[model samples]
Target: MTQAVAKEPAARPRRGPDRYVPFTEHMGVVRERAAAGEAVFSLELREELLNNHGRGHGGVVMTLLDCAMAHAALSRVNYEREVVTVDMHIAFMGPSTGKLVATGRVTGGGRSVCFCEASIVDASGDVAAQAMGTFRYRDAA
Candidate 1:
């Protein structure tokens, strides 16, 4: 008897993978989940995403953080609004050996910009990376 390989279902499309203007084209990062106006982004550990120690790459981590923070900021805005990253800083704590996910949310908000943070955890739920960011709001319709 031959075993059949099961395929996963396609994701529902709502918006562009990258909502930020500058990083819009870099859909290289994947948005695995989104709900409650929040987003969870993930990516498989690959050689390109590995550092000298064969762990999660810093650039990859930064990208994830930026996307997560941006999504979080956008979520806080009024109807049909956008935002731009003003300042972002990420601190890498440990190595991520497998698939990684970043959960992001807005910590503070105002008329101009919002403050956001995201925690990038490994499959084991260990905090591998974290980021703090600020975003400038765009005009809303």
Candidate 2:
């Protein structure tokens, strides 16, 4: 006689971030796509992410924007050079819903800094938020 047992499966391995980021990991932000001057990320809407108004928290939007912009900046150097956010401005365009996708693109920059813009689109493909940011390349410490 043999006993059969089935245990829960392990978590799926993700391609994930190039570098460790606590907040990004905690927020469950997934890297959808990325390139030299562009990046895309997504987050599944959950109760934990909602605000008092029952929509995605503004901070969540900002976090996604920041991460996306930073990824875009890092990709410019093939994910070798690090970067720090110098400034950011974000505008919320609509209520967040379902899964959200954030897209970031490098507009322009010099050797020391990168200028970027990012936008979050709701599941319906409507823009929910937009952000502009400047990131400076960090000198290795």
Candidate 3:
């Protein structure tokens, strides 16, 4: 005699603005809707994302900051316009564990360029990293 084994269903891919962006989707970033000039993003830390010290990788933290700041710059412009990072400076405050939450806001900008800042906080509510970025907006054809 044999008995059937139950299997768990596969997890569904997240859907939203993040899904539309290939890199964001690959990174499993969740985009939280926010008012103009602001954006929020979140990511779950996995073993693969850890550094040698068992903390979140610096590259991952930088990517999160870049994405968040870019999103913030985009928020202040027309949705059809594209924004590209011109310069970014990041400071890692401390190691991070568990889920990472990032928030970004546009500080200032002109018609063609914008300045933005972002901060990442760990699940424990400790700030893990912060960044300031300059982005240029490309007009749509």
Candidate 2 is scored at a TM of 0.85
Q: What is the C-alpha RMSD of each candidate to the true structure, in Å?
A: 7.4, 5.3, 5.8
Candidate 2, residues 32-131: lDDT per residue as tens digits?
A: 8779789999998899999999898999989999989988987877776678899999999999988999999999998899999999999888999999
If the candidates were sorted by their lDDT against the true structure, best first, what order would they fall in? 2, 3, 1
Between candidates 1 and 3, the lDDT winner: 3
**Which predicted model would earn the best lDDT?**
2
lDDT of each: 0.76, 0.87, 0.83
For 23-108, candidate 3 gives per-residue lDDT tens digits of 76677778775458898989998988889999999988888888788878777773556788999999999999999999999999
Tens digits of per-residue lDDT for model 1, 80-136: 566778998888888887888888988887888889889998977899998999989
TM-score of 1: 0.75
lDDT of 3: 0.83
Tell me how far the alpha carbon of residue 121 in candidate 1 is from the true structure, in angstroms, after superposition.
0.6
In model 2, which residue pairs have backbone atoms overlapping below 3 Å? none
Worst 10 residues of 1 by lDDT: 18-27
Regions of model 1 farther than 4 Å from truth = 1-28, 35-37
2 or 3, greater by TM-score: 2
